[model samples]
Structures are given as structure tokens and as C-alpha cells.
Target: MRQLAQSGKFRRDSTLLEAAIEETNTEIQERLKKDRIDFDFDPYFAIVRRTLKALAKEMIELGVELGKSRKSNRIGERQKFVSEAQTPFEVIELGLRNAIEGLVALPLAKECVLDLERIKQDYSVEGEWCPFRVSTGNLKFIVDDDGTISISLRNPSETVVKEAKEVLIALASQVYVGN
Candidate 1:
């Protein structure tokens, strides 16, 4: 009985040690990924694209609701005037611009700089004015007036890229529900 108890204790200790080693290895890998300065923008761009799509959907829904309300005779004339003053496309564009600006203002994106004029002048391949551009080191995120987003990443860190995605998503959620 004594020998069995001792062997059981040894096995438990070995298992614990293995688990600790595995945890440490995982931590190291995470640190390495975070520390990596060179990032490909494809993954990050996908994230942003998805976020923008969701935001656009929300904006459309809001616009439709506003339109429906305006069509009702219950709304006062002044309220109807206010609602009709801005078209749905205009509202969505303004909301998108504000959301992008808000994303840059987040703590994670403070290190990133947005240059609207530069993006318009340099990166607008469609011959249309680009509304915003965010730069982190050599990475650039350009958004055109028509809700198209493109990314240029140079020595971009995984941490910053992930944070950028998070910031955009958070802003989208906040702006979508008027919170």
C-alpha cells in the first residue's frame, strides 16, 4: 500500500510538471507572435472588412427604420423634415467616417496615425476621394468614400493589428446601437 501511494504521488508530480512546461511553451509562443514586427495585412484586412460589413448592415437597418417612421403620419412635420434632410447613404457614410475616426482614437490605435488627405491623393486608385487612412509604422489602412478598405502592412506587429481590429469592432458595436 505504501509503495502504491508513493508511485501515485510521483505520477501526479510528473503530470503537473508536464502541464507547467506546456503552459510555459504556450506563453513563449504567444510572446513571440506579439513581438513579431512584420505582419501581413491580409488577415487584419479580412477582420476589418467583416466589421465594416456588419456596421453597414446596421446602418441600413437604422436608415430603414427612420424612413418607415418618417412615412407615418404620426411624426410631426418638423421631425419629418429632419429625417428627410439627410439621405440614408449620407447617414451611412457619415457614420462610417465617424466610426473610423473613433477607432483611431482608441487606446490601442493611438500609436497609429490617420492621414485622410494623403490617402486621397496617393492611394485612391479608383479616381474617387478616399476618406481615411491609418498608419502604424509602415502599415497603412485606406478607406475609400464608397466603403472600400485596403491595407498596406510593413513591419506591422501582430499585437497592433489585433488591437486595431478590436478597436474597429468595438466602435462598430457602439455606433450601431447608438450607445
Candidate 2:
């Protein structure tokens, strides 16, 4: 929990530095050595990346265990293999659900969600690379200025990719048409 809190702080600091670098051409070395920042930018990101990687491995292992147990429970019945189940995706979906639920429960978010259906999808052009081909519930999109597009739907069970693709197309089209 402490490391997670520190990681969050690092992320926020990195975001600020990123903006400053863009706006004023700040030196990366200066950012690294600056005592003003709570966390060293490079080391902070390294820690976060390592932690996330470990977490993914642990989640995968837990999924395998659950799958084994589930299969064992069906011993004499119809041999349904839980090993083929959507374990990892299910785990990720649970986390996403919790976060979204929390957001919805917040007074500010609840009040701001008046146009629930019209909520705009936020897009980012830069971030860490995604390892999975598709997600189960959350949505990720990348649309470049040159009309190139890529999307990964966190929820493969739903139409997340299709919806994000449509939005990306609309956004790209608007940009192209000088809207």
C-alpha cells in the first residue's frame, strides 16, 4: 500500500515534469537531480513498472490456481476445464468495475455524470505499451495526427473496441475535415 501510494505520487510528478518539459524545454537531468520533486523521475517509473509487472505475474498465477480449483470441483460431472476460463480478464474487469463504481459514487462524479451517455472518451497519444491484444472491460485507443488508429478493448466480451473505433473514426474525420 505504501509503495502504491508512492507510485501514485511519482506518476503525478512525472506528469507535471512532462508538461514542463513540453512548455519550457526542461532538462531531463535537471528533473532527475532536482530535490524539489518528491521522487526521482526515472527510478520512480522503474519502480512502478517493476511493481506492475510483478502484479501481472501474480494475477496470472492466481488465475491459474482458481482455474485448477474450479476444474477440481467438477471432478465427476461434465469435465469443464476452468483452465480455459477467462481468469485474467475477469480479474482485470473486477478492478475496473471497482474503480468505475468508486468514481460513480463520488459526489462530484455523480453530479458531473448528468449526460452519462454523452461522456467523451479521453485519448492519449503517449503511454506505456500494452502487452495484451484485447482487454475485457476497459477501453484504450490511440489515434495519431496522420490518421493512423489503434485500439485495445479491455473487455473483449463487450463491444468496447467497436465503440472506441467509432469514436476514433469520428474524431479523425473531424480533424481531417477542419472541424
Candidate 3:
């Protein structure tokens, strides 16, 4: 039922850790004020509290610092590390039913948690592009002398979302970022 303060200047990764703690604590407080949780969700609430409180501890220990001289501490590597730290919070933030299901599957060792968490971010709900990947699906394209362009995605399922088709129609007008 209350709001947390805006984040201050981020001098280090600790800033994010502090913000995560504040966010989870605030969410718990609001739930207590506004919801009927005591009847059934007290244990789950404890898990939520404990997990989100340490959202950054293992990650900070794993070398997600901005200027770390470690070889694997590059920006790309940091992106993966940050995603690992954010998985538990995402179960709350994104309302992902599948993720919650995965978390409930128990008997997993804590050591395996890192790679398992990485799986959570390995994809979008839809899909992604990779230039190196040889797209085996039937893809057709054309570029006319007048520079008109068109593309066709031939999916094996033969079902592409209407939104994706709409996007393809408008794609030519969308300026390429690098260009």
C-alpha cells in the first residue's frame, strides 16, 4: 500500500541489490496490507522473502562487477550473470506460470542452480534471431529494381501469428538501427 523511493545514482552493482531488496520488501508489505494471504500463503511468502532478499549476493560473488578484470566478466558475460540473479524476481514480475512450476521441482542441488537459472533467459516467449543460424525453414524474399522488398516465413507448422505478419507488412518503413 506504499511506494518505495526512486533509485539513486548507481555507482556499483550494490545499487541494484539494494533496489531489489526494497522492491521485494515493499511487495510483501503491500500484500500483507491488501491481500488475504495469512490463511494459505504464509509459507510461500517466507520463500518469496528469502529468495528475493539475496537476489544479488550469489551474482555479485560470481563477478558481475562492471570493471572486473576477469576474462569472463565482459559485458556479454555480465548480461548472462545478471539474468541469473533476476530469475526468482521474474517469477513475481513476469507472472510466468511455467517458471513457477520449474522452481517447485525440488531435490536439485544449489550448485546446479546457476546453469538452470540461465535456462530461464535462454529465450523470449516468442523467439529470437541469430545471423549465424542457418534457418532451415522455408524463407522467401524478393527485392525489386525499384527497391520494393517482401519476405515470407514458411513455418513447418504453417501458423505464424497475425501480429508477425502485420509486422512484416510494415517492416520496410522501419529504419534499420545500424543504418
Candidate 4:
């Protein structure tokens, strides 16, 4: 019902936690004010609050001197160390996702989640580029020129192969339109 300012600098004494909530709610209300939507807002706020609180915890632990002068605490070296601490798996995953994001129409994680099992099925070049494949699961999919998508049923026995086929068809359609 009210507007929350997202201006100025972050403050230590301000109720940032509450301010974030009010700010998010105000934005959501403004965006949806024209729509005829009947839904609960508490669940959304709960998730936002949880995430904001977690970030607040990280900020506190990182200390008030997070971005202080490099001369005082060697800020550049501290950042280098933090960046270097990431595990190989984390780096690889980041790279893989970045590659997919750059090469494909979909977000990396969404693309991976959608095509992982299907990609594992093995590919034979279809054309200069073919927009679709039929997996062992009989999934109909678009094979990204830049990716090897694997497709398999997480619980093969629980779901029909037709589901994968449907996804593949949808993916192919998107590729056709996007390209």
C-alpha cells in the first residue's frame, strides 16, 4: 500500500531486514496492481525474508570492513582468496552453466535440468543443425549445437516415456522459432 525507497546507501543502523521486505512488497504490489490475481502473499514474503536473512548473516560474517581500502586490509588480496576458495566442481559447474547460457536460448540450469538425461543418450549429427532428437526414452528434443544433453528418467518406472517425448518436441519448437 506504500512505497519504499531503494535509494541511497546501505545503512548499519536502519532496519534493513524489514526495509527489504517492505521494499519487495511495495514493488510487487505496484507491478500487480493492474492484474486480476487472487493469491496469497505470505508464502512469497516468507521465501524473500528467508533469503534476505541468509544474505544478512553472510554480510555480518564478512564484517563491516568488507570493501575498506586495500592498503588497510589488502582488499584485493582478500577478494582473490575468497574467489580462489571455490572447489573445482564449483568452478566447472559455473563454467558449464556459463557456456550453456552463452550458447543456448535457455538459462543454463534449466537447460541442463531439461536435457541432461537425453544428452547422455548419444548423438549422431543430423544436419548442419537439426532441431530435434528422439531419445531412448523417445524424448523429442532440440540438441544445442554447443551442448551434449543427456536424457533419462529420474524414476523411469514411475513416469511414461511420453513425457520426455513431449519435452523434446517443445524444445525443438523453441529452437525452430528462436533460430
Backbone-clash count (model 3) = 0
In model 3, how large is the Cα lDDT of residue 145?
23
Superposed Cα RMSD, model 3 = 18.4
Q: What is the lDDT of residue 167 in candidate 2?
A: 54
User: How well is each residue in 35-59 modelled by candidate 2, as lDDT tens digits?
Assistant: 6654435656555655555454444
Model 4, position 54: C-alpha lDDT score: 58
Q: In TM-score terms, which candidate is top?
A: 4
Worst 10 residues of 1 by lDDT: 86-95
Better of 1 and 3 by lDDT: 1
TM-score winner between candidates 2 and 3: 3
For model 4, what is the alpha-carbon lDDT of residue 50? 71
Ranking by lDDT: 4, 1, 2, 3
- Candidate 1 residue-pair clash tally: 0
lDDT of each: 0.36, 0.33, 0.30, 0.37
Error of 3 at 35 (Å): 3.8
Q: Residue 84 of model 3: what lDDT? A: 29
Q: What's each prediction's TM-score?
A: 0.21, 0.21, 0.23, 0.29
Q: Write the per-residue lDDT of candidate 4 for residues 1-179, one digit (tens) a residue.
A: 01121222344423556676776676677678769555568887777677677565445434444434323544211111111222111001111211211111222221222333333445332434434444433433345544333243333432343354345334332222211
